[model samples]
Target: MDIKNIRQEMALLDDVIPLEGHHYAACLQTYEAASSQRKLILEWFTNHVIPQIPRDSASFLSIGCGAGELDVKILAAAKEQASTIAYVGLEPDSKQCERFTASMALPSDQNIRVETLNTNFEKYTEQRRFDRVLMVHSLYYMNDPERAIEKALNLVNESGKLIILIASNDTLNELSSSFWQMENGGSTWFSEDLSKHLDKRGVAFDRHRIKAKLDITSCCAPESEQGIRIADFIAQAPTGELPPGLRTMIFSYLEATSHLDGEMRWLPHNVDAFII
Candidate 1:
């Protein structure tokens, strides 16, 4: 249960896995469940967050903006109200950046400018701040989450805000705690832990819960390609190269806990959003 050794395990996973498209197919199975629950986060952002930005031209920075899908949605929604937005993305993967740039080319009546920096947030610097800064589901992999949060907060202009989305510690992360803790004595990563660090720093923030779940029945299918990807994602392993015993344990865990909601076999998620 040595905390220092946890990073080594994380690094091993990072070095071994390229996460591109690993969750895409699995996501397709849970689309209905995901869409219904995730809409709340989007609605909150549009109603509460979008109003914070200036109606004129505004700049946005999204760390780990994979393929710019959410950015596009935000931009399109902003357009409905006649706001101009310029997007800057920071993503380490070149292929993802390329996809982000390509997807943003859609013809739109709204004023928009798109740019992607193929770099990690730790090394990125800007002369000026942005109207909005987002770190969605990206902080878990950071070597230093507190520092990353601080850096993102600094990038927000005087009137802008830094928004972060992470999983609540009491929920799914708790279910999958054995793998993440590995030999670590306690939970090291999760929204609850992040909130504590922020609180210790006397940082003021607002919190909201976004209820969501994934139907992973397909993961249990015969030959289970989706199941394999689910395991890879949970383990953060590139090839899902888990020990036979560990794989069996994880599969048993998933099967036992999967909730049946009518026709859906749901794996519930408790996601939280922090606005600072």
Candidate 2:
């Protein structure tokens, strides 16, 4: 279950499912019960990160900017703080790029402008740097995560920063690991590993933990539509039908690690924040 093996399996999954669609959206909705990850990140950005940057005009580049929610949030915060901002988003899906473009439509009076490119980061050779380069929840999907990290770091200006947000291995790792193990898949990448990648490359960074939770109560039911959907969502590698034994094992592992409160089964979210 090394990095190389996990990456090969992830590439295979990506070939099957392009990482965007109805099931993916549904999975995101289900995970909304544990929203503290984004909240804490946003809080830190506004209160701590933004203030530390002395520049009044900031540039941001987002790789795999899904739905452009983070871009919108960043722009809104910048406007409130009287900071002029320029944002560029890179996404492979045309539909998602369209959404990212639409989400960036700021009012005439606002001090923010957005541009989007419909392409994956690996193929994008545009040479430009920005004040803030974002890789939120997108690094793991890269074809070469190390290369991508290096490219992103190279794109950061002297006064700029590379902000990365990823799920810690401690949270939801068992379910994904078990799913891959059943299929002879390898280990997946997490924030902890990403930090190691940075360290290996001699990149300096600051790490922070964001406390949150994940609700997997419905995933306990293997046969139901919700259960299957949850499995597909978290595994991100749903092929045809999952064997019953694998599903049972996944649910049992989830149940074992989960804490039940009323109708909600809460699993602690280990969200790690990296700033370079």
Candidate 3:
């Protein structure tokens, strides 16, 4: 499907699937499973990357800042350095942004300001430049990722940074096999050669790999319940419809591998943090 079609279908799914308690719980479970991976990704940035960036830079922008988790983390880190950081989050989902705003308890006295825009980054015009622009695990949703990156590049102040954390195509191929098998097809949004694309564009970036391990058995009853709810929500979507056998297989696969036996493994994602 084209970009327009994908957006329409996603909008429909968002309307049809109410992301309430169960959905949030499931997301939390997913987050727990991926916490280590997330930490590693962030650690790399804080230790190796952020030090290189001048703390005096004016602002930081995180595109698709779902639930503002990363925003909170980054802000907390910057606070430790007594950095007067301004944060801007651009999210496509209004509901998610609202939830994030409601739940966040960032330091009020700190020189940190958080603003979220409820619109697609591609269409949302940026009026000001930022010292850092980040797209974490959210770039694949864009209609034209290259154009999105280009726009992100444009939003950066001179000598600013643009960080993109995307799942490598191979990782998607493994984890989303069922998704790819669906007949209610969509265009492959993932870039198989994302690093090359960035290099060709002369975007200087450092790359890292994050390993996400899911252990089904370790999931408590609450977590499993949330997972089931998420599965149901996902299964009901048009793009999520799969042959019965395949669907069953996917669920069974998820159930069987929840214990982190190292049996169920996804490939490392290509995480690129570019200095523009």
Candidate 4:
């Protein structure tokens, strides 16, 4: 990673403008289509974790379950063992919450009782503990990840488990960290940091490495709308709106990090699953 180069470029910028509204949504869609985030998580949760799922309560507590797309799949994974799934999602984004509520209304999710709270994990006031808890790809948004993890764990019943999906010094996150700092004024945490925190707290956990990738050929196309959108998603910022030097630097870093295999540009999208 060209951390120094990105830092140099970011220093030339006033601030990072985070992509929001429809543009962000579009970029996310492109990223999702190219990445295997949902499939990897769903398969791992079903094959490796679901068999050991405690049957105390068919209830599931998902922290930062965005838009309910993955939540529906997760609940489905537990369906073979439990007739119905009680799903409660915690997300601070109201727009996403609305989408979640709408998506959960589909007949396919009829067996799951879905409840969404447009609030952060730290602000959830539910006193009821859940039999299973999940915090997939959502921990990076936490102001205090340790507190949030402890809170999520506290919400899990004795026989239940807490599954936290995060990245292990995820390469793409390194490319985005500089922009994130500019946007949030602080550094973000990764799986290694979380593991160290758990170890320091004497919380034993099993870490599983899940491999995935993305076809980032579109991201390499500097002028195309789809390319810009994917690049924006990668940097978590408006790549086109960025300072010229920083924008070029970031794309250079991305291109350098990505490897070419025939006609496809494969960008590593690996993640780590921490099961406690």
Estimate, for each residue in 8-52, the C-alpha lDDT of model 3 and write its tens digit. 333443233223354544554464454355677778768865676
Q: Report the candidate with higher lDDT, 2 versus 4.
A: 4
| Candidate 3 backbone clash number | 8
Task: Give a tens-digit lDDT track for model 1, residues 45-83.
Answer: 798777767877788898988777677777767666546
Residues 35-77 of candidate 4 have per-residue lDDT tens digits of 8766887898888877776554488888888788888777666
CA lDDT scores, all candidates in order:
0.68, 0.71, 0.58, 0.81
How does each model score on TM-score? 0.82, 0.83, 0.73, 0.93
Best by TM-score: 4
Q: Which sections of candidate 1 miss by over 4 Å?
A: 1-38, 108-110, 174-188, 238-240
Candidate 1, clashing residue pairs?
Answer: 1-183
The runs of at least 3 residues in candidate 4 whose Cα sits more than 4 Å from the true structure, single-residue gaps closed, are 106-111
Ranking by lDDT: 4, 2, 1, 3
Better of 2 and 3 by TM-score: 2
Rate residue 201 of model 1 by lDDT. 97
Residue 8 miss distance in model 1 (angstroms):
17
| Global lDDT of model 3 | 0.58
Error of 2 at 216 (Å): 1.9
